[model samples]
Target: MNHLIRIIAISFVLMPPVFAQKLVDPAAVAPEYRDAAEHRRTEQLRQRACSLKAQQAKILLRDRAAFVLKCMDAADASK
Candidate 1:
């Protein structure tokens, strides 16, 4: 019983790192498609960042969608 408990505790401790890791692995894609895959991953990450910014600024739900789009476009414009 003690061994089982220890294993369970260890599993819970290790689970977060697995979950926190990036969802997409561009290298896992075919070489010919890797660039496109990376671009998609970057766009998703950018969108999430914009959403987080909106949340931090307390932007309302109705306004958030537009704010996120504008934020992403601004980021693209700067790049």
Candidate 2:
């Protein structure tokens, strides 16, 4: 019984790292964003997108893709 308790304690201690990892969304990501580096690149793109999008006075919520595309184009242009 003590052995069972020790095993359970060890399992609990070991499990948090597995469970604490971030969950990536497949559909929300583009194909090029599979790597961690690519994902980090998109954060800058998103920030640029937001700033560019904020400049427009009449941007509809449904038209966010336009901002993302423009941001991606800007990133590509810089590269």
Candidate 3:
């Protein structure tokens, strides 16, 4: 049990340096790559917003058509 505990403690100390070396700081990324990444993100957001707006417009048109049909039904019923 003591040997196992020592092994675990040694591993805990050694693991951090190995993992730390793999980390990439965002500021270290090259400028052209960062700019391209930002542009892609912005374009993706714009496309999503446009898609949502189009969906909303379709829903509004469907509702307007339903309202018009209801009015027509009322007119026909009154006659």
Quick one: how many clashes does candidate 3 have? Answer: 0
lDDT of 3 by residue, 18-76 (tens): 43223234455787587666666655554545545556666575565555455445555
Question: TM per model?
Answer: 0.65, 0.32, 0.34
Better of 2 and 3 by TM-score: 3
- The window of 10 residues in a row where model 1 has the poorest summed lDDT is 16-25
For model 1, residues 1-79, the per-residue Cα lDDT tens digits are 9999999999998885545546567989999999998998988899889999999999999999999999999998999
Candidate 2 TM-score versus the reference: 0.32
- Residue 27 of model 2: what lDDT? 57
Q: Which candidate comes out best when scored by lDDT?
A: 1
Pitting candidate 1 against candidate 3, the one with the higher lDDT is 1
RMSD per candidate (Å) reads 6.0, 12.2, 18.5
lDDT (C-alpha, whole model) for all candidates: 0.90, 0.67, 0.59
Candidate 3 or 2, higher lDDT: 2
Highest TM-score: which candidate?
A: 1
Q: lDDT order of candidates, best first?
A: 1, 2, 3
Candidate 3, which segments miss by more than 4 Å at Cα? 1-32, 59-79
Output the lDDT of residue 32, model 2. 73
